[model samples]
Target chain A: MVLAFKNETFRDDFTFSNSPAAIRRFPFPFVEDKYMYSVNIEPHELGPKGSVYEFPIDIDEHYVSEMRDRALVLDADPGRCQALPHMITAQWDMLELLMTSMARDYPEHFSLTRDGNQWHWINRPLGIDHKFTFGDVATLPYQPMEYIGRQCQGDFSIQDQRDGQLWMDAGIITTQADWSLDFDVGMNFFEWHAPVPLAHQAGVFDRALKFLLNMQHGRPVRRLNWTMTINSRLDTSPENYHKWGIDRTTVTPENVGDKVHLRVELQALWRLPRSNAILFSIRCYMIKMRELATVPKWGRRLPRVLRTLPDEIADYKGLTRYRQTTIDWLSKYDDGAPTSLGGGPD
Target chain B: MSTIKSRPIYPGLSPDPNARRNVVVCDAAGAEAVVELLARADGEFAGRTSVVLSSEGLFGKESESIVERLKPATVETTAGLVPAIDRLKEILASATMGLRLYAAGSEPLIGSVVQAGAENFIDPLSVRTEHRGSLKRRVQCVHCKGMTENVTTNPVKCAQCGLLLLVRDHYSKRLAAFQGVCINAETPDESPELKVEFQ
Candidate 1:
């Protein structure tokens, strides 16, 4: 598919918005009228054409702008992209995964040509064509992971599997949801997720860890996780909480439709062939409440889901202040009507 | 939710009789724990043990008394926790097999000792730890990534960024500090009431 990439900004005078087509393929997270924590993982198999899951790596209209935002973030805070010394091999593994998937899935926008260890890659959208040795870091302009991660559309983390646990050894996370990659760099699965409430007692991590540990090469899995962002802002990191947290307070019934955004993460994990590490990709999709309400089924279902959300969850997702206002606004579209079963617009 | 999964749990110290060399790292308030650990050991354990004591704030006299009572093979005393950890690192540098590391002190001291051990290729979970002193915490500001030591309040101010932060039990062994995030970020002017929860 040839995508007419949008020119937008995710910060300061936020001009980011979703087109009608973008909203249709937004990866709406709710499968029902209510929501709660669950393992919700599924095989990352190809979905219906034009859907987000149609390809392993989904690059949409936001690709160029998102990459630009990532570059701006890296220029300001280079620590956002870090890799431990031992994760060098895993870095190359991730580079290969992203390059191959992109070149194969979107042939027009990207291409990869290989001659033994020397490889050539062309990213037409970003206007880059480079040739370098695959295994050699000195041959590339940046480290393998950062080089490829800069071009990718989502936050990528590599988890080194050892001691029967997955350690978050390397990542390039600029558009995170209130988490700091610097603080969480060396943490294991359970340790990084320690701040989340209620999921631990439900044995969510325990089950999820077991499932990821045995992940085989060429067989990846995916799940959807979500939170509400006050704007179309992407860099909602804890490092900038003092700057953007104030947006939550600014939400009112008057501006709830334009300001409130449902941020959904399409999290996928693939076991790397060489490093025995898992590549975790978090592709964020943001749609404002106004754009989401265009879909009849989603407009009816979202308010019901928010109204029944547990207090602990609402607080944890940082939606306590704006949730009621957004729900009240969305309730106008919910005519006490029955919606479809799955997370699809009808 | 009573205990955070990432928060390290100190399984109170127990002497390892089979170890050829024993190293004990402690703060002033942890002297009692060291004394009890040595007392419980069988067969001349103190003869092969070395102690690193940090008598930083209070309990100076108590630390001196414990040193006099438990006359281990060698005792190195420092004015603060930083120097004690440096001494511990030097000792670990020359360490061989059959070495058992024991840390008994405030969470910061113990966590630092464990972190130093980890840098020397020793597994942190293998280090014996006993919480003995003040419940004061060491917190890392999630914003500026600056660490503030000896935090005694819940909603403490970040020493670097000046943001009033809520100290969370979510901890990092690698960083050896609890995570601190802005408390009233949304409503910046409204600061929550401070509580001496850590103390």
Candidate 2:
């Protein structure tokens, strides 16, 4: 997965040669620094017109209530070990990744609103004497995280729960170094989630478009993920993955960059009859004001200094596009505007 | 971890504060509900709906990477924070520690733990690489157990204590990252913070 880029001048482009992928240090750092914009994608004239579709996500309320009751009994009787409801919430977070990527791709199409996300593993033994049998500790109608929601094109781990969580880390799933479900996320990317205002979504999505365009231009797009500030919301942030005993893993602002291949056969990659993988690009940069990660009484959130994001804000008026090249068309399923462009030299 | 103190379930709390450093987290229901129920006296998580924001309070396994149990939680950012200033002041006014929450999930994505961090550990750079290169190659003696001169090779023997001391990862040969330097042993009388250089 080595990313190759043409521009080596900006801080956003690839700086590390040792890494298999050519990286992008900073693209439009000024925009991110000024307006609080994150990743940026340029318009792709040659890139395929991506398909847009949304899947439904509706969870049952009864299922949540029943399982929650059982979870209480287990925690009440500590000796009678049971997987707590909170562990299910952690699992819920993992399942959200694929779901969100899908939803974001079709914001105008799909809206997943699932309520009562709980899981009760029935048909499984709870205690040695089986005093707390499947139904006693868990209930039906409980929606597991895997059942939370999903949108995939290939044979993901979800096909087999016996192999554990249907997820893979960055490394290969091979023998010797077998089943490395360990994905190396960037350093600055935090584990968090909350309802952010729609005001910021547009700018963020715009960045994604720009990042994808860079990939179409042979500029490798690297890294894609998001974290939300919860101090304003609540202390129970996503990073508190109690199930895995992980507060944080090793990641840096430098690695989120992804090298998207536009010319690659995308249709063939879609394994399902109507399934498709979303195409997106992102540009991550080093923040000047590195706020320390802190824990509060009720919420755990990262710093909210939006001012120190990318580069100089006021200089966009004069800058122009460096070059003008027609894009190579692959395949498009939607009829919406494909290019997210700027007023730079065309 | 939650800063809102709670009495031990069914009985009383830990006699020592240090021993009371473990907490568990649940969802809107279960273990977390108990914390809110128990903290009625302290008025900690009682009225607040954020009872589930504490990572440790979730139905989870406890360990070090998480914040201290019973610690307070707060947003680390200060942007557009004027409105939160009054609220932040109120939380800080209360006594105790806090920790951040990790909630990751998205619209269609089921396992999005948004609060997770990518950093396993981070060491800030307070010194320049060039500045550290000017210092001499100081080594511990492997033979005599003494800080002696004239030894230029790896795994040098001490002249005084006769103890053999091997340089860790001799091939890495980095100047800025000086390892195994007992700055305290060099100057027991001076403050360790002030004793910057081995020279």
Candidate 3:
């Protein structure tokens, strides 16, 4: 979990080695050679076996490192962390929710005490114990969400429900999965997902929006979204595409397995109690094709999925150029093995 | 000549070095291989200390004698592999470079334990897994994100959210579970049979 970095900075020199631990835990998304978008939401619960999503605010080994990385990203670009004028109250709501969740889930590190409107927060991990009035901006150094966001691992956004739809109003997103909040702010739910194909035609987005609108304040829904990235870098927004996009093109057939990574975003949506705004959080995870191959069935399924992926979807995922090469590389794992497709190895 | 009943074992990955310190994790189904796994480890990793974790209720009673003979530190988990993994996290934190992890269980158990080891910075090269148990699917409800275990019915009820889920053939490696959509998705009230098999 904690790697010895070359320096005490989030620099390019940071190299990652594939560990057995990572391979076993890697969420292999491809059930078949092709993937599709669906409202794959599930309720959060503790299984007979422990699950990662058992708690609302999950504090894992990546907690400290991710928080540090967020700080570094925010320090470089304050724009990455923003709260709209209308979302001020929602920000405070989010701050309280996160604090309470963390305090409950991780008692050793976080604690929250309230005396009416005045609140006391102690974050042992970050070494901060402070007292602040609930609604007073001057009581905190930064915006309410950003202050708490700095302590949490995932990037967050708060969408206000008004005029019969949800608005993309407020968030602290330093690590985005391709989309930018700068352009998305103030846009309605459908407008925000305007680029996602078939959802509109099939009425999936409308149905989903309505379901979110009706979601109870206390209850939350979570879903998973996936994409492929060229490297392990977290900053892959369009603004930085020139930096990472080039790597996608440069990946050779022999190295594609090691270079390409499956980036999965575990997104959760919660309806805030007071403001009626939805708190959306995204946590990104990456695992390479070679590492994925360690899981026998997963190794067999991906190549077929790539071969059958629709052109439009493949282009949307930016898998146009390297799809064939990646498939060829994955073919090495088949070894005449049976796939879910039920045929002799291709 | 009489024939011996032969059931194929799940082809699990093996650790080459097998190291001096071992942590063996297993569930009920994987209990069959515990003796062989331990013997192999003992041969390669002589004089090493071990901590073995077994899923609740399923740890083999017959294996208990061999386990007692090895004098290995043991933990039995009732709340799935997550609790066992939480314990493993502490042991791995202080673990030395030569420590090797062996997992023998269902896919979810192995996956969860592997994730825990990975979180502790264990190299994949030092970890071996022998998948045992049923192919019965673990399905996650799309409505609630809660997972229902050992589901055989196509339209299975989600244990967490109480939704009638149609377990899709598509599996999610991240959750180490399959996607289960509402059976009555289009026609909210009129439930329809999935009439499809899990691939």
Q: Which ten residues in a row have the lowest lDDT in candidate 2 chain B?
A: B104-113
Model 3 is docked with a DockQ of 0.01
lDDT by residue for model 1 (A1-346), tens = 8999999999998999998889988899999999999999999999989999999999999999999999999998999999999999999999999999999999999999999999999999999999999999999999999999999999999999999999999999999998889988989999999989999999999999999999999999999999999878999999899889998889888999889999999999999999999999999999999999999999999999999999999999999988888989999999998988999898
Candidate ranking (lDDT, best to worst): 1, 3, 2
lDDT of each: 0.92, 0.22, 0.68
Q: What digit string (tens of lDDT, one per residue) describes model 2 on residues B1-199?
A: 1111110011211111221122222222222323333353243432222222222222333422222332342112212112223233333345144322122111000011111111211111110011111122344321122344423444433456533343322110111111122222212343332222322
Model 3 CAPRI rating: incorrect
How many collisions between residues are there in candidate 1? 0
Q: TM-score for the second chain in candidate 3? A: 0.71
Best-matching candidate per TM-score: 1
Flag regions of model 2 displaced more than 4 Å: A1-43, A47-346, B1-199
TM-score of each: 0.98, 0.18, 0.58
Rate residue A165 of model 1 by lDDT: 98
Tens digit of per-residue lDDT, candidate 3, span A77-177: 66677676879999999999999998987788889999998999998877899999999989998989989999987789999998788987888887787
Per-residue error for A326 in candidate 2, Å, reads 30
For model 1, what is the alpha-carbon lDDT of residue B137?
89
In lDDT terms, which candidate is top? 1
